[model samples]
Target: MLEMLDNPQLVKIHFETHDDLVLVWANGAPPLVAEFVQVKGAEADKLWSVADLCLRKKQAVGSSIFEKSLDRDQHEETACFRIVTLRPVVSALTPLTYKRGNEARAIDCDEMVALKADLDGRMPNVVSKRGNGTGYWLDNCQWDARHDEVAVKTHNRMRLFEIMQAAGSLLLLEHIDILLDELRKLVKTAGDAKWKPDKAKKILTRKAFLTMWDACLAKLKDDAAQPSGGKLIEKMSNASLTGTVVAMAVDMRLDYARSVRTSRYMQPDEASQLQGRVKSEVQNLSAKRAAGTLDLDGPAFHALCVDRMDAINASLPADQGDRSAFLKGCMYDIADRCLLRFDRTGL
Candidate 1:
């Protein structure tokens, strides 16, 4: 979660006993307000449409404002009330294809409308009156509320990461790993002494360690951009992100190769075999073209590829049950790769 909201200037208080996620922004910027957020879906199996959850007395955003331990006298009041949900709200007015990315699914429009209606009635702050001898009116009750959907939680971490970057947080890679290891011991030794709000505030407010963090970030950035940094970049680039992209490329094999540039998943041994197969077939096509046995024209080459792929699929084992779809799809992927290679290298 720290990595998700990776802003150095933004410190979150995790009290180990509160439902409220408090965000304190101490960038010394004027008018910057603190945010109090409620994240739902911690106990739910699935998310549904409608605002039933929003008005819940214990867990909803509206109630959180009152339930939170923010002492108004201590200047801990927040200006933003937010709820983050894991699932999409599906409603009647929702488009059939609500989400564009394959990773993120769409929500129902009817569900969204219900939630919006429920929140609209409660939001923008409403004050009630009691006809007692003393007269008191509510002021400074305005707040901004938002309901957010974070698509596949694991898959779309980059969105949160980009937010961290935009907030001037550096992605320190290995250097951070080392610093964090040292920090773990530092924190452990410091014990609860530094855990107090005032003591902790001293850490960020004084900017005592800011120079050290800055130096490390600058050094890491400089090292990563130098000629020697090619190895670091390669190591970092070939992480699980490369495998994820490779899996996607394999899924979209029948399509163009635009998504295959980062292809890095298949085992080296298996890749060698596929490489051999591709080269052998390319060589055979080149020989046929040279001997005038095969036409090299665009349409002829395309037709020839289709015929060759069909022949290849015909050799699939007879036991391959329901042979129509998988066999055909496999053939298309190989054929598409071949065509893509030829287009790229003309070999």
Candidate 2:
């Protein structure tokens, strides 16, 4: 599924079909190619052999793994086949392993002769009736093995994280968990039994999948933008803040308010003057943010505000210049009062 998402050429995925999965690829119109995939979860110690592939339940004709893989040969569109498993293949099938530049593996002379002879004796009509010879089927078949379920999940998570980063998603790890769960539910729903036109519901098209992905990302961003309760916290929420910074912002807002009430080390006039300066700087930063001249994201925006406040403190008269922390608190107090906003304008 991760592979399907990564490939731009993939058009649709059909789950629980004649094959375990069918990946349809097309450039524009009707001449789509289908890659039929048969997924098998083999025992930990098992290795797939020629005999295993040729075996059929009740020794029935057209029921062997190879025959089932070729069933789609009767379809109009070009077809390729794959047997994806959790166990490795024996020596004769080693050439079918999926690797870079090795999507298809042709049977060698010796193995082809022996295997073809055996299959012909078991299912001669099936071999002779293929539009292309049995050799073509063998050449197009791929055997991809050792796909451990747990390892695949880990890989898919890493792939999803990369996708989020590429999309500039502000979501964190917990959010990724939520998104993955939602996506799994979507896959399960798509896998449910449905016929003909309704089977369209069973097929996940790339365009539709991407639309859902984009909508999920947009909702996460919207949810993050909503006010998170306390006055200062609400202001910080606009900035997309979380964890320690939010707690720190709350503390700063309270301390700055307390200092204003008691006039701890500074006079009332000094506090008022400092407040005006902080407001001026914030306005300037807000303008820059609006103009898109500052490209910083949420946390970077917060850090930039802190640095600007520290610079403001340094420029003040000696006694005032020493109170950098107090100035930072003053900034948060201004935010609490709605006189300052950490987020970019119109964002």
Candidate 3:
């Protein structure tokens, strides 16, 4: 799944298909290419052998591991097959262990000949189709083995962290836990049986995944950008504010943070200008209080808040002139950060 996320060419991912997972990629054209993967959680002591992969359930045809993987093969779209397991394969299958290079894996001529003979003996008709079925399978199939679940998870987290860093994420190390959890939930939801017959729900497109990823990053940024309410509540309490008013103020501060973070209903430049204007107003208000012209009373604080809201609203264009609540929220957010004060004492 992490690999799919890292791949730029990947367009869609399908879970719990004929294969364990399927990855689709496109190159600005008609037919789409796909890679079908079969995941095996084998015991540590087990080793995959040619005979084991060819073994059929109750002697039934097309029930073997190799046959099942080949069943997903379609001539309509160019596709490759893969078997990923936690156990190693026999020495005869060493060619499958080779890493992906120009192709999925490098197949030795002698090894392919012997494997083809073995598969041909087991399923002559199936192995002889499309000129040479075993040859095609040998060319496209990859065997990725000895993957420890815990190690893969750790690597996935590291990979995700690297991706976030490359994308200039401001999220901290602790936030990776949240992001990973969300990704896990997304995969689980995509694989849910209830969504069967609706491929849209079962498959995630790259565009949709990117949008979701951006939302997750934005939420982390918003959470980090917002000031904690504890100090704000204490300062408001010192100002003799009612509990209800203090709670409302804290909520407004959160609203302001989200609006600024998302640039909600505003262009990026407009949002920045509004924030700069609010900060300038805050500094001016602080200066007035320091000059002893502004009284250190709850009524005075309320009046100043309303006055600033009105002033900011008047400055905005006609379309945005009704954002009094948003302007007040911006002031409350400044107060939350100790940049604005309502009382004489700097509590």
Candidate 4:
């Protein structure tokens, strides 16, 4: 599928007996020595193995050469050849021949621009670093191949992670509403005259809540920046990336809620009620997951949480009283935590 074309731009190649050479040809065309040359005679087959070893070892140290001198006299070319190890071949004219042949015709700005555009379309960004050396060959033939594979795997993992984060976020928001409802009832039953139901919405929109959400979002953004993998095994392991993202979201929510309560809004009794319910939920979910009784997928976890919320609501007092605002805050905390964990971990 690959082809080479010649243009007015001159390219000269010099042969070096000290180093290995590969004769590249078009798919249907005969092997023609333009600038590069094939092995003198019997060394042709060894070219492939040498290329492979060069790429693998990342060194130019030569091993034994494959030669046909055993059966053939110094003059004749023989088909049969064998590999042998020795020091690298060196010749007096190798350097001079290469230096002279590297010179090419000067190009005007227009031609240079066009040529650069052509190359940009064909090669990856990394390939532009090499002009016309062995480094270019290594970049295009070896490193680029590996990089492409890693890029694909990384993208897949990030895609799955995003899905999990989104689902978890939705679940947490719903749970937030349930927690608020429960909190209102608890406040009312307490007969705490100081509690203000009217201020609940204001509290929900407080700077503290916004700050916590911002922190959680920042963490998610950082996760999104994780690099991709190159190996097949790594790509396949991305199956669990989504779950891991979800778990992290849950952890962020829990930590934020705790920070809010402990730092600026200390309400031990109210916070304790919310925390207790969440602790119980986690324990129950953990047991269920361990026993293979609950599925961690979106539908299953959401349904179970909804049922639990209904039960929690029914158990609360009829009137939320003056503590309605406090209850709503607690609910918000619990819901976010539950949603995050259930969404990702499937528990």
- Which sections of candidate 1 miss by over 4 Å? 1-20, 25-30, 48-52, 55-78, 90-117, 120-212, 215-347
lDDT by residue for model 1 (156-225), tens: 3444334434554433222334445544453344333434554553232214344545575466454433
> RMSD of model 4, in Å?
27.0
Q: After superposition on all CA atoms, what RMSD does each candidate show versus the true structure?
A: 17.0, 15.5, 12.6, 27.0
Candidate 3 lDDT score relative to the true structure: 0.72
> Tens-digit lDDT track for model 3 on 1-347?
56656777888888886467888878568688788989887454868888888889999988998888777775566778888888889887767777544342445567667877787787676752334487678777889884687887777667876665465442323456678888889888877854446677778788889888879877777664556737777777777886788878788777765554443255434555676787788787778887878766864675676598778888888976576666778778667767777777853
User: Candidate 1 lDDT (Cα, whole model)?
Assistant: 0.38
- The candidate, 1 or 3, that scores higher on lDDT is 3
- When 3 and 4 are scored with lDDT, the better candidate is 3
Give the TM-scores of the predictions, in the order they appear.
0.32, 0.60, 0.62, 0.22
Worst 10 residues of 3 by lDDT: 165-174
| Candidate 2 colliding pairs | none
Location of the lowest summed lDDT over 10 successive residues in candidate 4: 1-10
Model 4 CA lDDT for position 295:
53
**lDDT for 258 (candidate 3):** 57
- lDDT for position 287 in model 2: 81
Model 2 ranges off by over 4 Å = 27-30, 42-44, 99-125, 128-130, 167-171, 228-347
